[model samples]
Target: MCRWLAYSGTPILLDELLYKTEHSLIDQSMHSKLGVETTNGDGVGVGWYEAGEQPVPALFRGIGPAWGDVNLRELARVTRSGLFLAHIRASTGTPVQQTNCHPFRYGRWLWCHNGAIHEFRELRRDLMMAIDPDLFPSISGSTDSEVMFYLALTFGLREEPVRAVERMAGFVEQVAKAHGVAEPMQMTVGTTDGDRVWAFRYSSVGKSRTLFYSTELNALRTMHPELEVLRGLSEETRLIVSEPLGELKGAWQPVPESSYGVIQKGADELGSFTPR
Candidate 1:
């Protein structure tokens, strides 16, 4: 299991969210209250889209605890982006390395996941074989997270993210069942195309990991009128995380079980998720 967060809204310094909150992502990296593990020290990564014609988002990954990385601290202090993703890893069984870090990227899209395939070693070969030949060569890590990203890509992520991911989950479960694994998959996945962000929470088993999205900015302002931070953000601002960044009342809303949500320019959407 791992912990991650996605931010989309006004371009503010990264530290504002990664370090300034009561339980920031950096804080959660060491003391996660809701994750399966208390310390997610295997590795860390951040991916963000700059405001420009270039579609590709920038990536910074390191194979060390995020809280101990001076480089990560320096970068977060000075950088700003309207949309970004940050993850702290906790290896289920894979090696700890930079290439295995989250926020895996292809073209203009970014993705990260916080759960695993129940018996990945037994199903890896079959799942790998199912990936499109042209896309298979791009896989750079051994973690199931990266494989899941490419699997989504191969299943039409660039065209239809929701459908592609549902297909990806369905395919993984199908392979795992063949291998005699009862509960084959568990994931709280977040992805974006530098424009809109999509997040999903689901598992073959009924219970899944924790996930939540921030309450609407306008509503938060009304709820906590004195909070200065809420004033600077736009109504469209949004955040989805593996846990609440803070205990601020009305600041976070749990994503429903086995569901997905999208954060874009207009009204955001929350809906049921079903693997194809």
Candidate 2:
């Protein structure tokens, strides 16, 4: 599995989340405490939206570890965004190339996944065929993560992200069953369309990978009144991650297994989610 973080809040510098945290995504790349793999050096990517600009999010990905990428450091230090996603890839069974990196984009949407489709080789063909023909041509990598992203798109992600993802998981299970694979899915995904961000955590057996979201900014500020940055952020500021960025008590909460949530300007909602 990989490690990722999604930020939806004030227009702060990328490094504020990517580098300054106690266990930042960059730090997780070399020493992850919750992921299946300790090192996620296959590749890394970042996608962010510029406020007041077009809906599309810009991307920067490389076939190198996030901890050692000078370009990533430079970009994170200067670039600022209200909504952004960053991922460090640990390929399950795919090549370490830029094309296979996370934060896959489709028009206004950007997506990243931290878990894999068990025995993807057995389900890839069937899953690929289910994608809409028009969307099929846009797939550029062989990873199940990208395929899952496109599958969500085919199922109406642009119109209904949570429902589309539920359908995508159901479809994966259906295809895997036909191929004789019982345990077919595991995922902790984050996606956005430059405005609202949606995150999901689920698996076939109910023990999904780790996922957490930061406490509401106002609450965090009240908890740690000395932290100036927390006070400067908007009340709607939020973060979803594969793991907690730090050990700030009351600052992070685990996303329940088999659940999904939405993070937006002022419409945050968390509810039960299951395949279909």
Candidate 3:
């Protein structure tokens, strides 16, 4: 498994979430309490959309432990984004390489996953075959995470993210069941297209990995009026992560199991998720 985070709202340096928090993503890369593995050192990646009319997000990925990556630290200190994704990888089985890192991108979208397709080797060929031919050539890594991204794209992620993901999950299970894999999927996926973000938590066995979203900014502001950080953020600011970034009281809420949420400019939404 892996540890990842998605942030949207007030523009701020990436380090605010990557390094400044009590238990930041960089800290989780070394001492994760919620992930299956304590150290997610295989690789690290960050993707973010620049302020303005840029259609695609920028990416910085490296095949090295995030905690020791000076390049990543330097970049995080200087770069700011209103919307971004950061991930620290712990390879399930695939080779640890830059291309295999998370925050996979295509056109105006960005995606990252923190779980696996059980028996991916057994299901790889079928899964790969299912991707649209035009999209298949865009797959640059061998991780099931990247394949899942392309699969979602093939199923129409651009038009309907939640439904496309549901279909992607359904299709993976459909292929896995045919290969006799009992527990076919485990995932906590996050995706965005510069303007909005969507996150999902689900698994075939009904025991998915941990995922949490930050409490509403207004509520947090009221609860911790003394905190300086809370004052700078907008009401629309939101964060979804594999674990709580800090121990601030009432600062985090668990995303319900087998459910999904959407964060946008107006009112955000949390709803039930059912695979097709």
Candidate 4:
């Protein structure tokens, strides 16, 4: 229903990813070849953490088409970050408002999702009720995406991201089955706490939204040695997105179905994932 990208690597201008590629996030906002919706104009948001600053990210969001925003254009051109997330939303039943935008933030954590809870109206109340009471009051939006973030927080995302997401998914399935919904969840979610990023791709029925992460920077450089930019970036740099930002051969790799991966300093790890 939407498209998003998470980048962790060398510090670089946001525009490099948001605007410069053959199929940048801005271009994807208007013409997404992989998403269910060709145009995702409901809203847009970007969250980034400055090096040496607090782990919490800075955010800029607007309830307007990203392609038409002068402010977004200016911000993207000037802001540089080592870690950042940008999302373009196409509302899936929820009202199109700033609060409903992706890249929801809580403390030092930032999160974004590109899919939804199937039959959300039938499952919303139960899902909300399952969130920890202390955390419920902080939920400021009505989208299932935001609720799912809080659910992960309740399940202990701060300490065990993979397991926490598993618990959240299991909880949703439990509630959905009780309410007679055959398929309860669908998601390609990305989350981070300034240091590492964890991305998950899964659904109750096996088919899920598209998600891919860039290949190792060293490999990409060797494959495309003419691309000077790739050589300048850190070997630790990585990007995970709903689709490839460019068509460079061997630049992207699919995140396997029903699994999750972590992008960190050393070798990135991809492992099998299930709801429970």
Report lDDT (CA) for all predictions.
Answer: 0.93, 0.93, 0.95, 0.94
Relative to the true structure, candidate 1 reaches a TM of 0.99
Q: Write the per-residue lDDT of candidate 3 for residues 101-143, one digit (tens) a residue.
A: 9899999999999999999999999999999999988999999
**Candidate 1 per-residue lDDT over residues 153-232, each given as its tens digit:** 99999999999999999999888888888988899999999999999999899799999999988889989999997899
For model 2, what is the alpha-carbon lDDT of residue 217? 78
TM-score, one value per model? 0.99, 0.98, 0.99, 0.99
- lDDT order, best first, reads 3, 4, 1, 2
Runs of candidate 4 with Cα error greater than 4 angstroms are none
Error (Å) of candidate 3 at residue 141 is 0.6
Report the Cα lDDT for candidate 2.
Answer: 0.93
Candidate 3 — which pairs collide?
A: none
Please identify which of the two predictions, 1 or 2, would achieve the higher TM-score against the true structure: 1
Task: Kindly report which residue pairs in candidate 1 clash with one another.
Answer: none
